[model samples]
Target: MKMFWVLTLAGILVAGMGSRDGAVAQTRVPQKVMKYLESHSFQDLVRRYGNTTIELSVPSREARYLDSLPYRLEAGFRVQVVATTDKQNASNIYRQVKQLQLDSTYLVQEQGLFKVQVGNFTVRDSARKLLDQLYYAGFKDAWIAPATIHIAKKAKVLPTPSDSIYFAIQVMATHSRSKAEETAQTIRKKWNLPVRILAEGNLFKVLAGNFSEESMARQQLQYLREHGWPDAWLTQLLPN
Candidate 1:
C-alpha cells in the first residue's frame, strides 16, 4: 500500500516537475536517490502489482510485496565469495579501507590468522566478478562460495537514495568534476549503475544506488571493480 503511494507520488513528481514560466512548488524527492532516478522513469517499470509498473531493465523478478524491503530475494543461481590472504599483513589494508569508510570486515577468525572476506554474493557471477578484482589487486587466491544461499531480507533501517543507481569513482575529499565524470563513465558501462557526478560543496562523492539494500550496492561495487575499476568503493547516500 505504501509502495503504491510512493510510486504514485513519483509519477506525479516526474509529470509535474516544472513549467517554462518557472513555477515554484516542492514535492519530496528521495534526495539521495534523485540522481539515479533521473535516469529512469516510473512508466519504465512493469508494475509488480499488475502489468502496469515498469520493470527495472535488469533480470530479477518482482518480490511478493511492495517496497520489497521486507523480502529481498536472490535473483541468480550462483553465489560469490571474495577471499584474500590470511590477515597477517591485512591490518594496513583494513585501516586504509576503514579510513575510507567502507564496510571492511572479516569472517569469524579461524586457522592461524584472520582472512578478509568482503561478501557472499547471491549470484555466482557477482562473486566471480569481485574475485577478479581481488586477483588484479595481487590477491590471486580469491574464490567463490555458493552454498550459503537463503531467501532473506537484509533489513536496512535507513532508507538510502531510494531511486536508481549510479556509481562514481571518487577521492575521499575533493571536487574535480572531470575526474568524477571519468570515473562515472567507467562504472556506468561496467556495473550498469548509471554513474553520475555529485558535488557536495567541495567534497566530490562517487555515488551509487538509489539502491534500497546494502547487498545490492555491494554487488554493484563488485561489478564495477571487476570491469577495471579497482579503486572504487561503496558510497552511502541516505534517504531524505
Candidate 2:
C-alpha cells in the first residue's frame, strides 16, 4: 500500500509540471503532490520575481530658502560716530544719548568694535539732516552709514494733486521759473506745506494744497495764517 501511494504522488507531480501553462491543466493534485510542486517555478514566476524595476521620481533633499528672502530695496546712508580709541568715546556717546534724547543706541559688533546708530527712519533726507545737525552740533565724527531698511512691500503711493473736497486742483500751467521757485520754497519753509506754482500769461499763482473739502482747505489756510503767512489763500485751480 505504501509503494502504491508513493507511485500515485509521483504521477500527480509529473502531471502538474506538464500542465502548469497548458490546456491540460485538468490534472488532479493530491495534498502531498501539491505541496511538493508548490516550490517549483514557471515563466510567470521568472517575469515577476526576477524582474528589475527603476522608478522615475524627484530626489530627496533639504529644501532651499534662498527664494524666500525679501526683494524690498532701501536707499542707504551712513552715520559717523566718535571712534573709540579707548573707553572715552563710547562713554561720551552713552552720556550724550541720555542727555539729548537721541533715538539711537550702541551695537556691539565684534571684539573691540562698537557702533552708535541714530535712527531707523524711513526717510533718507531725514537721516541726512540728522547727520548734518549732529556734525554741526560739535559731533564732527557724525556721518551716515549705509544700512538696509526693511520697507514693507506695498504698491507705491504716487505724488499727485489729490483733493478730498470733491474737487481736484486743475493746474492750467506749471513752471520752475523764479517766482514759482520762490513760492515753493516759501510755502515749504513757512507752512510745512509743499508749494506748486502755476503760470497763466504773466501771472504766477501759487497753490499750497489739494483738498476734497473746501472746509479742510480753509482749516489749512487758517493754520497758515496763524503762522503769520497771511498771503496763503484758496481758490479753484480747476480749468473752466
Candidate 3:
C-alpha cells in the first residue's frame, strides 16, 4: 500500500511541475502526508528547520565577457548658453532653461566662471539645431562648442610639443594669485577647456584654450564675449 501511494504522489507532483501557468493540480495529496502537514503550521516548520540565505552567482562566461570589453570614449559637441562670474546668475539661467522644458541643461563651474550648457550631440549639425531652438526661445548667446566629454573616466593622451602652438583667449589677469586661480577654476569647470595662469612678472595672466589656429581662437573669443566674458582677447601660444 505504501509503494502504491508513492507512485501516485510522484505522478501528481510531475503534473504540477509541467504546467507553465502553475495552477494547482486537481490531483489530491496522499492522505498521510496531508495530515502531517495540516498538523504543523508553515511558521512552525520554518522555525524548526531554520533559514538559509542565497546569493546570485555570475556565470564564468559572462564575467570573462565583461572583462574583455574595451574602454570607450564619449567626447562630442554641446551647446553652451551662458557663462558668468556670478553663481546666482548661473543658477537663474539654469532654472530658466529648465522651465522652458529644455531637459539637457547643465550648470558647471570653471576657473571663476559658471556656465550653463546643454545637450550631448555627436555632430555639429545636431548641436546647431539645438542652438537655433535656444536662440528662438530667447537665449541669444547660445553657441556650440566641441569638447571631450567623459561618460566614465577621462581619457589619457600625451600631447606632442607642437600641440602647444595654438591660439588662446586671455579673459583676465590680476596681481592676486587667489584671483587668478578662482577665475581659471571657473572657466575650466564651465567649459572643460584648458586654463593656464602665467606669472608674467608681478601679474598673473589667466588664459583659456589652445586653439590650433587663429580663426578658431577668434571664434571662441566671440563666443566668450556673447556668453559674458566681453573683454576676452586672443593670444597665440608658441610651442616651447
Candidate 4:
C-alpha cells in the first residue's frame, strides 16, 4: 500500500509538470505579466538590494536640501484675488496678479472655477495684510481665506547609529523634494513608522523602517506593497 501511494504521488507530479510545460508552450504571456516583467529589471533589484553606503548622520548639504522641502501642512490663510468660472478671465487676472509678484501666487481650479490665491500665512492677520496690499495693487476683490499651507521642513535628525547596519523599506523616489517629503509624512502618519528622506542626486527617496533584521524589513515592505506602494522594496543600509 505504501509503494502504491508513492507511485500515485510520482505520477501526479509528472502529469502536473507536463501540463504546466504544455500550457507555457501553447499560450502567450499575459500583457499585464509581460508589462510587470519589463518594468522590473535585474538592475532595479540590484540597485535596491545591493551593498550601498548609508550616511547615518545628515550631511550639511543634505541638511540644506531638507530645509528647502515643505515640512507639513497647517491650517492657514491666503489672499484670494478672484474665483471665476470664466477660464480666460481667470487667466487674465492671474497674469496681472503674478506681475505684481507679491508672494507665492497660484491659480488653482476647484469646484468649476479658477481661484487665484497668494501667500501662505499661518496667521489671519498676516493674510489680511496681503489682502490689503492686493487691494491697493488694483485687486480690490482680494480677501483673506482660510486654507492649508506648506511650511519649510526643518533639518532631519537621523536616529540610527553611524556604525550600525540596518534594513529599511524604500517606498518611493521622486525628483520633487516637496512631494517626497509629503509622501514620507503621509506614510509616517498612516503606518506610524520611522520614515526617512534620502536625497541622492536629483531624486529624493522616501524610506520607512529602521529594522535591524532583514526579515522585519521584508515584512514591512510586503505591508507597504499590499497597501499602496506596489514597487516598494527592501534595502540594506550599510554604515558609512
Candidate 5:
C-alpha cells in the first residue's frame, strides 16, 4: 500500500509539472511548497541553487564590470534659475527652463530648498552666458554657481549578436555622476529592472530596462512619466 501510494503521488507530481497553466499545477502542489515558490523569484531560485551546487571560477568578473564604469569629477559651473522652498514654484521654474530648450537641466535639493539649475559648463563664462539668457528670459534672479560635475567619457557600445536592437527609457540626465547613480538605484529598487548609466557629451544619462519590443519600452516610458520621472522618454539602442 505504501509503494502504491508513492507511485500515485509521483504520477500526480508529473501531471502537475506538465500542465500548461500554472494554476492547475500550483493546486496540486503542497501548500507549504506553493507558498515557498510564490515568495521566491526564478532568479532567486537559480542563485540559491548555483551557490550551493556550483563553483564560480571567476568571481572577479563582477568587479571588472563595475570597474568598467567611468567615474571622473571636476570643478564646474551651472546656471541656477531658481532656489525656492516651495516645491510647486521650483517645478514651475523647471518647466519654464525646459521651454527654453537648454542643453542640460536638473533640480537639486540642498539645505532645505529646491534649486533649478541648467547648463553644465567647465568655465564660469559659459555658465554666465546661460545666466544672462535666463535673465533676459525673465528669470532675473538666475546666477552662476560653482559645482562639482562629472567629466563625461565616451561610452563603448558593445556589438549585439546578430545585430539585434533594443530600447530603454531615459529617466534623467545630469552632470553629477552621483546623482545619476542614485536615481538609477532608486528606479531599480522601485521597479526591479536593470538600470544603466551612459555618458554622452557632458552628461550622464540614467536609463532603465533593455526591452526587445518598442511597444514594451513605450509602455514603460508612459509608466515612468506618470510616476516620479515626468520627463522620462524612450530611446533606441542599436547594435554597433
Candidate 6:
C-alpha cells in the first residue's frame, strides 16, 4: 500500500513537469492562466492594503498666508528727507512736511532708525527737483534715495491754477484734507504768514506768500528758510 501511494505521487509530479515543459516549448503562458493571476494578485493587494488612508495636515497660519508676502516690492524713487534713531525727530520732520500738505510724506521706523520720505516719483529728475525743494525747506540733509515707496500710487499734479500770473512760494502738496488743514493752521498760527491752501486738481497745495514778481517770491523764499520753512520753492501760478 505504501509503494502504491509513492507511485501515485511520482505520476502526479511527472504530469505537472510535462505540462510546464510543453508551455515553455510553446514560448507563451496560457491566456486564461495569465488573466487569472493578474486579477487575483491585484484583488488580493487591494483587499489587504487599499483601505489604508494617509491623513495630511498643515499649520493653519502657514496655509492661510502661503499665497502672499507681508511686504510688497515696487520699482520707484523717493526723496528720503531724514533718517534718525529719534522717533520724535522723524515725527517732527513728518509733521513739518505734512503741514506743508505733502501727500507722499511718511515716517517709517526700520533698523532702529526713524526715516522721513516723500513722493513716489518714477523719474529721477522728478525726485531731484523734489530734493532741491526739500533742501530749501530746511531739511538740508535731504537727498533723493531710490527706494520702493510704500504707497498705493503717486499723486498727480493738476494743471496750473488759473488765478493769474503770480509767483508764490510753493511749500508742499498733500492729498489728505486733515493733514492740509493741520499744516496750514500751524504755519498760520506760528509765523502769521499768508498761507493759501489751493485745490489744484487732486492735491491741496500749500503756498506761503503770493508775489507779483518772481524776484520778490525768491526773496521771500529765502526769508522763509531763514525763519523755519526750508522746502519753499518759487512756483508760478496760472502759467502763461
lDDT of each: 0.46, 0.48, 0.64, 0.66, 0.67, 0.60
Lowest summed lDDT over 10 consecutive residues: which window, candidate 2? 1-10
Give me the runs in candidate 1 sitting further than 4 Å from their true place: 1-175
Give the count of colliding residue pairs in each prediction. Answer: 13, 16, 16, 0, 0, 8
Q: For residues 1-240, write the lDDT of model 3, one tens digit per residue.
A: 011111222122211222233443445556775776578766664554334322233346665665543322367767898878999989999999978764246788888999888865556665676688899999998899875432312212224266467677898879999999998999889767788898889999988887664544554554565455656777777856
**Candidate 5 versus the native: TM-score?**
0.38
Minimal lDDT window, size 10, model 3: 1-10
With a 3 Å backbone cut-off (N, CA, C), the pairs that clash in candidate 6 are 99-183, 101-173, 101-174, 136-230, 136-231, 137-230, 137-231, 138-230
User: What's the distance in Å from true for residue 151, model 5?
Assistant: 2.3
Each candidate: RMSD: 18.9, 23.5, 17.9, 21.9, 18.2, 25.1
lDDT agreement of model 4 with the native? 0.66
Cα lDDT tens digits, model 5, 1-240, are 000101121122222222223332322445775576578766665555433321223335566665664524568878888889999999988998889876567888988999998855666765565677789999998888887654433222233455787788899999999999999999888887788999999899998888776645554554465457757877888643
Using TM-score as the measure, the top candidate is: 5
lDDT, candidate 2, at 198: 68
Ranking by lDDT: 5, 4, 3, 6, 2, 1
**lDDT, candidate 6, at 136:** 84
Cα lDDT for residue 45, model 4?
38
